[model samples]
Target: MVPALDSWQFWAVLSAVFAALTAIFAKVGLENVNSDFATLIRTVVILLVLGAIVAATGQAQALGSISGRTYAFLVLSGLATGASWLCYFRALKLGNAAQVAPVDKLSVVLVAVFGAVFLGERLGPANWLGVALIAVGAVLVAQRM
Candidate 1:
């Protein structure tokens, strides 16, 4: 059996747990702070923690060793992440965390579509059905009664 620590499914589940906690914590944290400022603070904390982890793990690499294409893609991804955080924070500030988080999770659907189109990833019919169900579920969860 694969070790739980080394399993992608295990990490993904942890990520989801942490993400859920982030929404709840962020909602509380945003009570008095500006959403953009809250996001900035969160980003700084993330950078510091990740930097420490990389240093402790000896995973730091020389910037020159990375390819220009990699740098470009990483920059684009950073910008996208910043934009997403800003939008998510704003939504959380204006809406219930329960509602905001489900709508934000629509990113999973987008990722599947974008992966297929841009990364040449393929999904079978069952996978597509699951994606469709996720979209519907997100919409349903985000609805206010």
Candidate 2:
């Protein structure tokens, strides 16, 4: 028999493999399934897991500690995440993951722009250079397809 990996090692490897599979499977599944329905199912599964964890950990009161601003952020994040999932899955259906992933990473540039415009944030010169590199990488990957 093969040697078993350490639990942490197993988790790391499993998570990476699962993440790649998520893109691949989501791409394939979205070909036939409705993206919105798939997102609903995905959200339900996430909520079930989180609820179970809270119940098991006895952190039920943690819910009361959540502030209104935190709740608003969570709701906005969830909506954005769901929208991203829909787009990613739909893109996967249309194109290769190799191509889709790098293009998806363009969100980094968008995030930086958002931070600058909305959050009154600024990136250093090195960060601006990094953004340029990211854009070039994404462009090359996308153009390859």
Candidate 3:
């Protein structure tokens, strides 16, 4: 059997747990602070923690070793992440965390589709069904009843 530490599923679950905590914590944290400023603080904390982890693990690499293409893509991804965090924080500030999180999770559906169209990733009918269900579920859960 594969060790849990080496399993993608294990890490994914941990990511989900952390993400859920992020929403709850950010909701509480945003009570008095501006959402954009809160996001900036969160980003700084993430940078510091990740930098320490990389240093401790001896995973730091020379910047010159990375390809320009890689740098471009990473820059784009960083911009996207910043935009997503800004939007998510704003949503959390103005809406219930429960509702905001579900709507934000609609990104899963988008990723599946975008992967197929942009990355030539293939998904079978069952996977497509799951994506559709996720979209529906997100919308349903986000409804203000």
Per-residue lDDT of model 2, residues 1-145, tens digit only: 3355646787778976887788777777777777777767777988999999989998787577889999999999988998898888767767888899788879889999899999999899999999989999998988854
The TM-score measured for candidate 1 stands at 0.97
- lDDT, model 3, position 19: 96
The CA lDDT of each predicted structure is 0.98, 0.83, 0.98
Collision pairs in model 3: none
Candidate 1 worst ten-residue window by lDDT: 1-10
Residue 105 accuracy (lDDT) in model 1: 97
Ten-residue region with minimum lDDT total, candidate 3: 1-10
Off by over 4 Å in 1: none
**Candidate 1 lDDT by residue in tens digits, 1-145:** 6699889999999999999999999999999999999999999999999999999999999999999999999999999999999999999999999999999999999999999999999999999999999999999999995
Per-prediction backbone clash count? 0, 0, 0
Model 1 backbone overlap count? 0
lDDT for residue 10 in candidate 3, whole number 0-100: 100
If the candidates were sorted by their TM-score against the true structure, best first, what order would they fall in? 3, 1, 2
Misplaced by over 4 Å in model 2 are 1-19
Candidate 3 error regions (>4 Å): none
> Any residue pairs clashing in model 2, and if so which?
none
